[model samples]
Target: MNPNTTVALPQRGPAEHDRREQIIKAANEHFRHYGYSKTSVAELGKSIGVSSAYIYKFFESKQAIGEAVCAQYLGHIDATLFAIADNGQSATSRLRNVFKSLMKKGLELFFEERKLHDIAAVAAANRWCAATNHRAALYGIIERIIVEGREAGEFERKTPLDEVCMAILSAMTPFSHPLMLEQKTPEELEERVVAITNLVLRSLAC
Candidate 1:
């Protein structure tokens, strides 16, 4: 190297990004094992080999970390629903698939990861940005399906699109909302979800 030639500085961006991800991953595992409400930021830091202050550098508070973890879980469901919406199936079929997938995924979180589900419930109860965004994404998916059905001449266009979408969401609330999922067994939800979805589909038919 020539004397006085400037050496490229090591990039902190990727390392900082990796550190932030590591914090989220560790917090997720901690929350899953111990539950989000019970786990503190100090516990999370200890689990991840970082100080509480350092973790705070990546997240504003324990609730912020919980939001990140909740977002990760909800994001998976959103992606799955989006894929179903875009599939080449008839709009009716895609709409039905979307309802079924939402119920299936909600039940999975409620039953399989009971503890982790608390974070989601909290997010919803507080109208946290993660939960709000997830709901919007779901609504968008439903709207897309509805638009497709109308364009295909399979569904009535008489109903205002917003009204139809809201009606569908309200009908599916018991099966799709995290807190509401607690009211019934998986079997009960399955039976009712099918009935509700079919009812909505019939109402939409041209």
Candidate 2:
């Protein structure tokens, strides 16, 4: 019976969201350019023209900022895979689209945004077990697609789905590894991804 006892709250508008994104973007650039070890909160804040205390308001620490950047990168991959899966295409077509998008996106992030790629690589290597878990989740998405394709009789393979999934992920390793990606031109790397993907498809197809 206390109608007037309701509390009012402030709404988070687009501007606040945009400012947060800007801070993250600036942090990502700094981490990428200087490597995570060299990047400091004061330097990042200076780059964004905010005080170190203000940076803390957004992210608790540099490690937290790095994790957020990595999450953003993985989010893009998840979105692309889900979009392809939702399309009304054949299973094979969807699978192919996923690989193509993966390769293209990987190349863009590795070559064009080389600094960010390096930062992520260093983080993942140092955090091996956590990185492996993250990778397993990513591969689980791909495995689901394979399972659907197999159920529809679109994919034919004798291997267990988990094995096939590991193979698919193994094929993508070069793209994620900075040393490997560094040794090749973007075109060459793209070709390598396509070749490996084709091999996996051939093994899986009827």
Candidate 3:
């Protein structure tokens, strides 16, 4: 799925919205326990005290439910990163904070639970809209930091802004990307986060 693509959702009344939330909540729990690939819409509906047909009214297919759950999960991280980006810190400090916060949250949310991690891994591998959008938002945050740093004379301006942003993101991907986060132990991830964040900062230095 393209990160920038938008799906137009039909407008729902308050009751409809509440019902959809209920379904999503139950699916999240089920997926967390049994994993996305193993769980079925019929099973999720039964758990939520609804019929499989009724569940389909809210979500077109099991993949739609999975996407919704994954989106909700990533929404939390998006909020955390956005807050750090706008916290009025120096660009250097904000950039470092962003990387560290992302790595920490990625591990705590994804790696701590293997089943939930699988959902993320699948979303990433399949290029689900949830994962793509999360990545796009992260790039925006990084670009914003670079712009601020350039304005404050803390980052080099000779390089194109987008190029620098992409370079930093590429360097930090091992720690921030879902599939790569589990490639190392938590202790090892932390060490790499520090090393990569500091190295990126050095490269950005004016």
Candidate 4:
């Protein structure tokens, strides 16, 4: 971790933990409503009915608060992947399920928090390589699934497993882009995800 990173020290008591969670939630709402650059500590404190100093007790700075919000968002993605891994499905099926879940969650985030999603999208476009590697751990899980599937003779692709993982991730990127948010129902989005996932699976599956 960077020296500048203010680690969220684990809260000891119930009240303390609740307060910290409340501050983080308030910050997330503020960031979602007004983009990261526009959200102020004072505005966040006012929304949470606390003084700016009190907010600082839980979070060190606006950038720290932004990191917390991003961590929470990515944490959700991690949980979904873990759930799929625990579903007792074959490796191929697990990979498909994970991608579908990810796409569904992306759509939810894109539509429900358009401003925050837009901010993240712009950041990603500007730092595509770093953003891509930032999620390397998650992609590693998919690569392991591909390797397992290949060993089981379930996926016949001769391309390297890492390449296959990248292809799967690439297929899901459209769901996260702002362009996809125009005039699309949840069901339609879900169908599109399912179709794309199936196509990738077909191309790779034995």
Best by lDDT: 1
Using TM-score as the measure, the top candidate is 1
- Give the lDDT ranking, best first: 1, 3, 2, 4
lDDT of each: 0.83, 0.69, 0.81, 0.67
Better of 2 and 3 by lDDT: 3
- lDDT per residue for candidate 2 within 1-206, as digits (tens), equals 12112222112333356656877798777766786678888988888788988777766677767766766675676677778887878777877777777667767877678777776676576653324444655576577788889988988867887777777777777765555667888778778767877887888987
**Which portions of model 4 miss their true places by more than 4 Å?**
1-23, 32-38, 45-61, 126-134, 177-188
Task: Enumerate residue pairs that collide in model 1.
Answer: none
How many steric overlaps does candidate 1 have? Answer: 0
Tell me the tens digit of each residue's lDDT in model 3 across 61-158. Answer: 88778888888778888889989999999999999898889988888877566787788888888877787778777878888888988999999999
lDDT for 79 in candidate 1 is 98
- lDDT accuracy of residue 30 in candidate 2: 79
Which parts of model 2 have CA positions greater than 4 angstroms off?
A: 1-25, 32-35, 45-60, 128-134
Candidate 1 residue runs with Cα over 4 Å from true position: 1-16
Give each model a TM-score: 0.90, 0.73, 0.90, 0.68
Q: Compared with the true structure, what per-residue lDDT tens digits does model 1 show for residues 8-43?
A: 211223435877788889888888898987888888
Clashing residue pairs, backbone N/CA/C < 3 A, model 4? none
